[model samples]
Each structure stands twice: as structure tokens, then as C-alpha cells.
Target: MARADALEKLRETLINRRRALVRSATGELNQLQGRSAKTGDLLDAVAESLQSELNSQLLEAESRELTAIDDALERLDQGEFGKCEACDRAIPLTRLRAVPYAKECIECHRASVKRRSHPAATINRVFDSYQRAQ
Candidate 1:
């Protein structure tokens, strides 16, 4: 069916993207390491070190995204593609196209981002529920 075809297309896209991310991250890490070997003026050395640190952080983030892409591929193989992991609803094609590795539908994704950005509120809500039980 069309859904299956779409899922397959998305799967291919995710695989290709994962490959590109890995290649780019590898190149960045290599450049950072190689560039660190050179000695320079005090200010230049400081700046280079800072840049290397930033690149390392970015590469780490890319690694996390690579893991997500792999998980999406696995889900596609299991016939669970195109469904939100959080709510079990169908993820829109637009979202899939925008983020081929997305595991949450748009609504759930928004709620998740809100929860992450407001940990204090989440904790307070949990504490309030506990108080109601007493």
C-alpha cells in the first residue's frame, strides 16, 4: 500500500542521513584532534581549545541523533513505523518528512519538550499528587 511505500522511503532516507551524520561527525572530530596538535600564541591556543571543545560537544549530539536514527530503522523493520511511541497515534507524513527519525507525534513531541524545559513544574505536579494521597 501507499503507507508501506512511504515508510520504506522514509526508512531509506533515515539510513542515508545516519550515514551522512556519521561521516560529518567523524571528519569534524578528526579535524579537531589534528588541529589541537599545533602550538600557537597564548590567545590563539585558548581559542583553539575552546573551538575543539565545542566541536566535541556537537559531535556527541550527532552521535545521539545517530542512535535515534538506528532506532527508527529498527521500528520500521518491526512494522511499527509512522506511529508515535508516546501516544500510539499515527504520526503525520509532514512530521515524518521533516524528521525521519521522529518517534513522537507532533502533539506528544511538544508536550515532551515542554516537560523537559520545566522540570520544576513536573516535580511540583508529582509532589502535589503525593500530597493528595495523604
Candidate 2:
């Protein structure tokens, strides 16, 4: 298929996915809110609070994904949809198929993952070093 046609298809898919995600997230949040209002017992209140926290985290993640989808749609409008933002290389159709909102090519994405140093990794390394020194 032509690049423009592919981009249009991807744009439609992302928009639909975004709508579904928003609806699901909204329904779940509403359920949690309703449940929280009726929790009279301490344990029930605690459980509802935990559920609400988890729902909030999930909603946060969904919101981020929604933002990415929106950005991809904007990029489609700008005629830069399939190009990797990091390397300016054409992102593979396969990758775009797998992740409609992907911003970087596989190689650039892998390099970015490699370059990142997580706090958990640092903490683990420090603990291992301290254990070895004992």
C-alpha cells in the first residue's frame, strides 16, 4: 500500500483505539468512585482505596498512551508519521503495525533502552557490590 494510505489507516485505527480506551477507563473510574462512596467498614474501605489507587495508576498509563496516539495523529497531519523522531529513519511497517503510536525506529529504540540507567538497576548494583565487599 502507499505510504499515505497506510498512514491514513493507522490514523483511523489509533483514533478508534483511543476512543475505546477512554470509554473503558472512564467506566472503570466511575465504578471505583461509586464503590468508594458506599464503603462503611474499615477493611472494605481499605480494599476500595487500594482498588482506586490501582485504577488511578492504570488510568494514568492509559492517559499517556492516549497522548501518544494524539501525537501520532498530529504527526500524520504534518506528513511525518512513519519517520523515527530520534534518527529520522523510516520506521518499518511491521513496527508501526505492532505499535501504531511508536515514535522511534527499532534500532534507535534499542539504543535508547541501552542508554537508560534505571534507579532499580543502580540500587541492585550497589547492593551487590556491598555484599561482595563484606
TM-score of 2: 0.80
User: Any idea how many clashes model 2 has?
Assistant: 0
Compared with the true structure, what per-residue lDDT tens digits does model 2 show for residues 43-100? 8888888888888866766666677778888999999999999999999988787677
> How far off is residue 33 in model 2, in Å?
2.8
Worst 10 residues of 2 by lDDT: 118-127
Highest-scoring model, lDDT: 1
Alpha-carbon TM-score of each model against the true structure:
0.82, 0.80
Which runs in model 1 stand beyond 4 Å of their true positions?
118-134
